[model samples]
Target: MSLRTLSRNEVANHNTPEDCWCIIDHCAYDLTGFLDAHPGGCVVLAQSAGKDVTVDFFNLHRAEVLNKYRPQLIVGVLQGEKEEIIPTNLQDLSSVPYAEPLWLRARFCSPYYTQGHRKFQKAVRRFFAENVNPEAREKELDGTYISQKLLNKLAETNILAMRLGPGEHLYSRRLLGGVINGREFDYFHDLILTQEFSRSHTRGFQDGLMGGVCISLTAVKQWLRDDDLRERVMEEVLSGRKKMCLAISEAFAGSDVNGLRTIAQKTPDGQCYIVTGTKKWITNGMFSDYFVTACRTDKGISVLLIPRGHGVETKTIRTAYSTSAGTAYVEFSNVRVPMSHLLGEEDQGAKVIMSNFNHERFVMVCSTARWCIAVVEECLKWCNQRISFKKKLIEQPVLRQKLARMISLAESIQAWLESITLQMCKMDYEEQGKYLSGPIALLKAYSTTSATEVSSIATNIFGGRGLTETGMGRVIEMFNRTNKFDAILGGTEEILADLGVRQVMKVFPKSVL
Candidate 1:
């Protein structure tokens, strides 16, 4: 066979000659230099070196490598080849990387305990001060004031740490700082979760909390291994270097732990599992770096980390929220992941999943409660400023009564969340493992539904302006979107209510008997 020549697209995109042709089994193959950037390793590329290993490539490497790294590499044309089977794993190379700084890693990774030590607090405070201010008019139009502010904070934290070259330990510290220093980090967290950072901090709290769930999951998974995937993910998360989202919910399943339809069955070769199914209502579904997804495996339900691209198609769905962190309908048609990507044992995914849900639910409650507090504060501020017929809205007894009720509702949720958060802080994983599932469900249900009510009251108080996009109008929009999401994601209110019933049933029967 004559040596195939490289296509203009492939030749232009190759980083180096060593990375020129990724040969698979001596067919003189070229896969566009995706191996080096592969989170799994360069070995995946090495395995495919030298031949027309096309069949093996399609069966083994297509979904695994192409989907995740296609955006980064370029495949040159082969000599004497009639048709080039563009790898099934290829991604669109159209997306551009955000020009964020390297120091973001250090800020994100820095430990909370040490944030006050040395100049860390000062530096972080300065970072937030510089970035968290309300935006200029031009900036405000392009991005929402809240989102711009939060992004500024996120960018500042990410860029500074990255420039400082802080390691993973420090990066973790920064993540804690963002979580604990409510005043400084909470806004950004809210923005991150709700994908509405550009809209209103209070409204975006749910999205930020959702993002936190994925972040926490990444952290936990990192703790499970010391490999390159762990290192890369840690580096990305700590420095705010990479953006990712989770895919846990499916079309037919919504908090029904055992009803997942996505399957990760082992291939006949026993080398990998062919993951096939559609994941719906996935947060960050459209724009995530990789998906930490739950799929039914032969051993049970298992969580697998699948990179986006290739055959893993994503379709964005319009929702009440406009931020479009790109909630998507993801179809994994025969997507394959090696055994290494499996989180925990086969079929035992429920145990790992349950544990994660607890943290997720707790964070969601705390964040949503915070949003309610913010909404109440905003309403109070608005009431103070706007006067009707020579009197402030706060002066009206009816409005006062409504505000009081809103405040009370917010406080109730906050008190419960604080109590639960404190308990969470005290328990070891093993201890938490024992009691988290049920209470978490209850907390999520209570907080989200309560937040929705608070948002509605706040909107009513704002009247017509609440329906617009000016002043506190943004807050109303965010609150409305988050209110809907709160009852859905993590665990639905109905699901949690059912869980509460089950919990009560388990205990109440004994007393009655």
Candidate 2:
């Protein structure tokens, strides 16, 4: 509905409980209907009726609160008042300093993003902001699974296919609803997807919705030998008709692959294998119809494609984050699978697993970097408007220092990620597996460790609200709870750091003094 301009005297006329009105930052809001629902009670609105409440509103609430309620409450802007143009365009940089990547800011330039990339980014961001974010928030709060309607939206828009990363399936496929063709997709596009989608502010539900498919499907597409079976699985998942997950970590093993106890024994006929094992902390396991499993074999460890059926069990594992992720403890009891389900050669589970690490760790880097930025955004927004000691919080030098440090860390990690992504775009899969693993691991380690510090300072800025589940610090609260996930998941910082050094040492120059 179009709003009409209202004069101050006109606003003053609606001054009773039956027709209450208040001006917030020069915008008139008809709160007559909301008086009884006001948390502060009717007297507060009654007393402020017919008066400008801009100062009083800022003193009590964050700007986002106004954004959240404006659509419903706003009636008109005061005559002669110029409304602030808060941007809704996905490509527009937030006028707030350090809120977006430097390249997105006005007067900045970059060789990395093309017109097509920009279009793709805008389309995906708009989709998430309008559709995914709202549902993600609801599902995260209620511990409900992602709706099939949402999945259908993702499928029809080719988002599900895009998450699998660039592959044969993308050939001739329309991506971002035709914003870009699938063949044009690269690491930059993948990076854009991860970063933009993280804006949903519902981290756990983000994983619950598509994280499993993103990580697990790569292993299937790259290693699985049966072309027919692989195609079938891919079609099912890309259509959003079936769910899949990677079953790797067991209670006895996390980073240590050799310590896994899951076992697969080949039949005497050599046509099948009986798989028995348990996987713990499996993302998306609770709802997956297919499990890409890791198991110990006669020669060594092996990878198998196990369809869910009899003797397969999954129980929800509650986490610091929400249960919407479908985190699970899974058990397999002598489940039979065709030998054709083997991924890559037998006893080569390590190789199969390694195939996914570069992409996985890179994705972790993208997520943590964006998540840190998100926390910084929350701090900046809160500090700018929050009143304390008769002054805005940002007026304090100490708070500015915190923001400076957080922005530096967030921007630095993003620069490193962009450099690495550029290399990923140029390198072949084999080359990435060979030379990029250590660097990717190190990037993840640094980004997530940086995230730890960012989350801490941001929470300090938000104070009690940072700890609260709702209101001004909602994003901060979620980040604080879930930020540690990146630090430990994929690969731990200590392990990745050591691995990076070890990898470089393998090719270190002997003559270097």
Q: What TM-score would each prediction reach against the true structure?
A: 0.63, 0.94
Worst 10 residues of 1 by lDDT: 94-103
Candidate 1 global CA lDDT score: 0.56
Indicate the residue-level lDDT of 7 in model 1: 43
**lDDT against true structure, model 2:** 0.88
**Residue-wise lDDT of candidate 2 within 1-513, one digit each (tens)?**
899899999999999989999998878999999999887899998998999988778766766678877899999998999766352554454777778776666778788988778788778888887779879989999888889999988988888888877767898787767888778898889988998878888878988887898889899999999999999999999899999998999999999989999999989999999999899999999999999999999989999989999989999999998889999999999999999999999998899998787898898898888888778777887887788898889999999999999999999999999999999988989999889998998888999889989989988988898898887788999999999888887878999999999989999999995
Local error of candidate 1 at residue 47 (angstroms) = 78
Error of 1 at 238 (Å): 3.3
Clashes of each: 55, 0
* lDDT tens per residue, model 1, 1-513: 235465434533433436545533223444545556655577655554443445545432223344344334424344444554333211111111111111122433322223332234344334433443233222323422224345445644453223212234333444423533322332123222222222235433224322532434443353334377666665565445455566777878877757889988888888887889998877656656577788887656888877776679988765665433456789998887777766666677777677666655655665576577667766776676576767778889999998888888877876566556556555756566566567767877887778878888988987876676554456665676557776787777997878866865665656556
How many Å off is the CA of 401 in candidate 2?
Answer: 0.5
Question: Which stretches of model 1 miss by more than 4 angstroms?
Answer: 1-129, 132-216, 219-228, 504-513
